[model samples]
Target: MYQYSPFDRQFVQLRAQQFRDQLERWERGELTDEQLLPLRLQNGWYVQRYAPMARIAVPYGEISSEQLRMLAHIAREYDRPDQALLDSAQQTQDVLQASQPGLTLAAPPLKYGYGHFTTRTNVQFNWIPLSKAADVMDLLASVGMHGIQTSGNAIRNITCEALEGIAPDGIVDTRPFAEIMRQWSTLHPEFAFLPRKFKIAFNGSEEDRAATGWYDIGVQAVKNDAGELGFAVKVGGGMGRTPIIGSVVREFLPWNQLLNYTEAVIRAYNLYGRRDNKYKARIKIIVKAEGQQFIDQIEAEYRAIVEQDGAPHTISQAELDRVQASFVVPPLAAANLPSKTDTQSKPYQRWLAQNVRAHQRPELRVVTLSFKRVGWAPGDADADTLDALAQLADTFSAGEARLTHEQNLALPWVHASDLPALYEQAKALGLVQPNIGLLTDMIACPGGDFCALANARAIPIAAALTELYQDIDEVTDLGPIDLHISGCINSCGHHHSGHIGILGVDKDGKEWYQITLGGSDGSALSGAALPGKVVGPSFSAAEVPGVVEAVLTTYRDLRTSQAEHFVDTLRRVGHDPFKAAANGARLDAGHRTRQAAETASA
Candidate 1:
């Protein structure tokens, strides 16, 4: 984790103070909603259906135990219960349930406040009041965290592989580069606003866990034939009404040129990206429109910028050394295997198999803490849970934890011998789920329940599917599946990259779901794949669980063996079979409805 220097602390405090003044002015009626909208948005504040929502950034998904504790304290202290707020929450939850009949109610047992993790690996508090928003920002700054650039048409959080430093097959630890980008892009005057919001992701690992291809900019750390480290820059990738896989603009860019090249790309987009129509405003749109010409323009601009005396290339060696030193891996316990008596329990074995991974160091391991328990919304943790997890991290993983782009937490350096004890502690906190890569371990967005942009309810749909596959044996039998849901086309849930993608859509005034099959983010053995293709007509939310079940059943029947994952089978069999199966399920449901109606009439 990168420690904040005194200068870094000063910068954050200055931003917080400025926001406080702006908020005060707004409260005093010095600014209208239109005038205040962009200001609040850039600071990650939004006025939602019932209350205001505040997004707190967790940079590269790394947080110290102290920072986690601060978040817990913020959840408990700042968010007090209000009857009106509760009523609004209930109303939203009701709408979610209406779309998905027979779904379990998703209202968690609340105290003062709740925090939900987002696909960007950030946490959002939905009940934040306008007056309290600035206070929350101040609290965050006190702990070297802030929500700046988390929203609006600016470069949002600079994300990278959560397992960057520790993944066994990782080519290079990209966290240092990611942190450098974050510092440079934050409040950059040139890109303070843009045609639309931009996102950037980096991955050094062989497996693309960071969804690099679906970001506005994707940087893959690579080593040249001479063994010198550099980057492969991909641009124009994003998802929304238009989904695209980023094109490789540069096959190999020297590591020293990272910042200058990034600036050049954004500068080109800022000058020519669509501004009149928000719908077609992403850099991906412009990249598509211009094709090779766009890359040519960026290359020209990059060369010109590199010629400047105080260009991005001026970053000092001393600064690089300082930043790298902050991320040095801590010493680990001596190697020791756990005794059979400690690991023989069935539940322990299952959890270890699902949530734990081999570390590069034999004495250590990486453990994923699952947040996908039944009855709770995916990616949600209460204040107490966060507090307890923070304490556990301090004791078990050297006072730090990492949040994955998949919306799960990772204890990156748990000793191999500490497995049983850590599992027990995590289980007590309900963070142990033996389905890390299975059907129930699905990725979902807040959807209609909380998001103003959502057309349908994603949370309840995810909950219903989890309940439908309560049998662990059934989920495991289904094999590894990536099921992702997004409430709308913004693709916050990265649905386009999932094996089975569910997107919520508006059919007239009703909530309906559109299913896409045979899509993946290129994790297949072949290294070639396609984005999900929509099946047939959209189905109602109530029909989603059954439709999903039908699709899974089709996969199971068609797969040659359990080893053939859902995406591979879908590729082999194509979407026709899954579409037919979903259509069949819909027909059966219609027949059942008619039969019941006829019997009642008789």
Candidate 2:
């Protein structure tokens, strides 16, 4: 649980009071909604289709237990107070309500309600009324917390692998680095107002759990010649209107110079990044527009910044040591459980293979709580399930909970012996699905349902595809593959990075989708495929699985059996066959189709 500093606390109260006064003026018919909107939004407030929803930037997915309890407390007060069960929307609203403070606004004029939940390290909430926003800010300040640079053109959040400290295989514990960056970037005067939002991610795992490549600046934990821990810095990657993987600028970087390097990169972006073209606004475009070679030269220009000035790096080594000390690993007993009778049970072995990870210490195991069960939504976790997971973390995993970027939970430090009982409890709560990297563990965003920008619904499409892959055991046996679905051109679901990506489109109000293949998830990427025309939803569902099957079938025959796999075979033969399967014939070559097209047109 992260404790906020007094400065952080006061900042929260100040922002809340500011918004509260703005709300009062709007209600008195003195301000237009458009004029009042941005002012209200500066402090995590937004008016949505149904009601207002607030988004707080949760830098590094680090929230205190007290803060979480406060979130639950706020929700219970909002809707169904007597029932003790607030509906999802209303609950989210209360958590999002901007903290209110000094502003003299009539609290009675505003009826406030809010709720809190994490969606990819961003704290999302259905927000309360604007009038009482100040009081909420006061409460948050008392707890040593505030919401700054959570929105607008600023450093949104510094994210890391959710299992940072818990996972044994991770290269470094990212919490220290995350906290350092968080403090460094919080309201940095010069870099505060940029052309657009900026996000950073850090990961040490080989699995790329932090989605390193999909950030403005992604830092992956790596070791140099000295065998000391540091990060391989990646620059200019992002998602949304334009998608590109952050290219690695440095093969190796020393640990102490992280903040310095980060400042240089941001400063470079601040100076050269586009202000003219909003579509081409991100640092990715700057990297692309300036050319990677030229970008490298520009980075060289800022070597002085890295060596000397910019981002004075407020946090020191001793400070970093103190911060690292704060993240206390859960205390687990030394005894190991008997492997047989425990892991050998029916679902036990499967669960162990899929959900469990070894810890840095020998006696404990890290449990990856998968959200993808057969019937339920992929990332959906009910209150009971959440509470149950919290209890399991306390029981088997040294009383600690880790939230993953994949929108799942991790009960780190679980004893191997206790896995059977823990599995049973989790299965009852619908959290124990023995699939971690399989196709069913797909990343699909809330498309048309919750997001106003969505062109088509992505959730149902992903679920249907999951069902298809489930229906075919052969396809399921094709090893791990990423199937991501985004509802619109923005690619909010990260479809570009998926091995097989689906982007839903609206063609005259009917649902349609386009498929893109070979796009990678990690840093080095396979470029996006040429998407086919808008195929209606009817063909989308039926043809999607069929295309996958056809591709697999071709892979089996053309391959040196299953050992060659899908990606390797695709790399060898190219996308002609897949295009033929998804689209129709006449796609071979001009020599073969030379006469055919003339006759069709004639």
* 298 Cα displacement, candidate 1 (Å): 0.7
RMSD of 1: 2.3
Instruction: Give the TM-scores of the predictions, in the order they appear.
Output: 0.95, 0.79
lDDT score, residue 70, model 2?
50
The number of clashing residue pairs in each candidate reads: 0, 23
In angstroms, give how far residue 541 of model 2 lies from its true place: 5.8
- Candidate 1 residue 508 C-alpha distance from true site, Å: 1.7
lDDT (Cα atoms) of all candidates against the true structure: 0.83, 0.63
Per-residue lDDT of 240-274 in model 1, one digit per residue for the tens? 99988899999898887888899899989988898
Query: Model 1, 483: alpha-carbon shift in Å?
Result: 0.6
Scored by lDDT, model 2 comes in at: 0.63
lDDT of each residue in 1-602, candidate 2, tens digit only: 44556665677677666666777788898899998765666566666544455565566775444454454444444312222223554453333222211111111111223233343565454434455455555555555545566667778767887777666677788778888788777778756778777888888765677777778888888977778877888888887666777788887877777877777777778788678877887888888778676466646745776555653553467988877876765455633333234556646777787778888767677788887655444565444444555566656665556666665677767776777777777777877766676667777776654567777666556656666666424444665666677878877677776677788677666555677766676522233322222222223333444555555555566766656655556667787766655554112222234565577799
Error of 2 at 43 (Å): 3.7
Model 2 alpha-carbon miss at residue 148, Å: 3.8
What does each candidate score in C-alpha RMSD? 2.3, 9.7
